[model samples]
Target: MSATFVDVEDVRQRLGSFGVWIAPMTLLTTPVATQRAQFARIESLGYGSLWSGEPPADSPMGGREAFAEHGVMLAATERIVVGTGVANITRRDPAAMHSGAATLAEAYPGRFILGIGGQTGDSPLSQLRAYLDGMDAAATQVLSETAYPRLLAALGPKTHDVAAQRTHGVHPFMQPVEHTANARRLLGPEPLLIPHQFLMLNEDAETARGAIRSVFGSDAGLPNGFYANNFRRLGFTDDDLLDGLSDRFIDAVLAWGGRDDIVSRSRAHLHAGADHVLLHPIAHDLTAAVDQLELLAPLLHN
Candidate 1:
């Protein structure tokens, strides 16, 4: 896909690396009314985008309409870009994914951004590589003629390079600031670098860590070694994964505490060169997640 290059400086000035992702499972689990409310609230909070993660499923809603719902949410306001923090390359053919993204872009105008990534869970390496290669082709095809900005949910070196060469930049999850720094270097001074960070707000170290572990335990064993290996690279031992997050481990990876504390941690990523920070609150309750956003507003609004 051919794409007009997004000005790295423009994206950085506007976003400052602080977008948020509402995973599909989480969004579906939350009542539709509540999700709509959440979208409106997030836009009002001055966030740049409402990101969605699509799982590999043979469903229509899992396609463009998912993020378009986010655009509809943005219609309730004036700013805020909406994006599929990623639609897997494995699930849709590039032509189809490109068409869906282009359609959404046409529907929403500049309010849409396209983010793509490799599928996690179980898939053969050969197939995964094909998917990544397809991503490169699809991104070029989509962006070749349009102005839509593209990002990759990269987890390692090669994927990171793909982000630099073919797309706008990278959006890494379950990664440390160290990776953010590395990503910036690889993408150079021109790519839009945004990384998603898990968030919480408890002061008691163990309590905060436990919440993370509960989520991680369920998500970590997926076929992708990216998350688990990244944890180890950040000093987390396998033993740390068996039960729950250790205080030391959680302190290293998650952003927790008061509004100022969380904002400070978020800043660390920006300082490391992320153009946008995609916030994923570690909570199930919609109200609780909104509360976390409220806590974050004071820090981010300035």
Candidate 2:
């Protein structure tokens, strides 16, 4: 799409200063009632939004339908916003993505955001831009005009510009405050800039970093993926990335240790120019995730 207009200020206001972003692998396995209650509790706790990561169907990450989970999240909450952190475009046709998002938007109105990305090719940037074109064409056929914002998962400067022009703004994942600052500088001021911060509550560095590595993989080997390359651009050395993720890089990206410390890290994103920040707690299960959010709730006052 070629920058269809959206109320950027409204989106910024609804997102608030801090919110939760999680894949909810464990919760997806639970009963409908249980999932509904927990999501409602998070809304009751005053979270501005809930964002879920969508792994492609049949992948080890475990999920086929991002839209179904989004529907449940929206239905359970009376106020809090629900969104895909970034629904991979490769997983579904543009028409399907647009209609599904429009359906939710028609139901919940401003409470739904459709964030999309995950393109791979010799020219990933060109691929994503083309994907947006497809989505734009699909928007012509969407029946209802119920409004919602769209955000791109961008890292490089060019993609960031594309995001600013083509969508509301960007939803950057697994990046540090420095990246947020750079993005803000590139985007000027009005565009929505929500950076996803990874969090672990452990006090022990070894154990905490181990958990992150297991989830992220590619400790000693494997191709340098999108995230690792972004880290490199941020000045993280190969050594920092290769040694099961060095303490230096981990310390930059993860909000761990004291509750105050985590809050401080999130605030740094705000100071660096993030309109909002989504904190994803990498916990053992759903209960631990909720506990972590509850623990941070008081400190994250908007």
Compared with the true structure, the alpha-carbon lDDT of candidate 1 equals 0.70
Question: Mind giving the per-residue lDDT tens digits that candidate 1 earns over 10-83?
Answer: 65665645777765656666666776777778877888877877655654444334455555555655567877
Q: How many collisions between residues are there in candidate 2?
A: 1
Q: Candidate 2, residue 185: CA error in Å?
A: 1.2
Reference-based TM-score, model 2: 0.94
**lDDT per residue as tens, model 2, 1-302:** 33345687888888788888876576566677877888888888788999887875445667537889889999999988888878888789887888888889889978998888887769988888777787778777674365678888888788898987788888998898999999999888888888999887777888777777776674552138787787788888888887577778778888888788889998999999999889898887766788899888988874
Error of 2 at 294 (Å): 0.7
lDDT of 2: 0.82
Clashes of each: 13, 1
Candidate 1: residue 186 lDDT (0-100): 77
TM-scores of all predicted structures: 0.83, 0.94
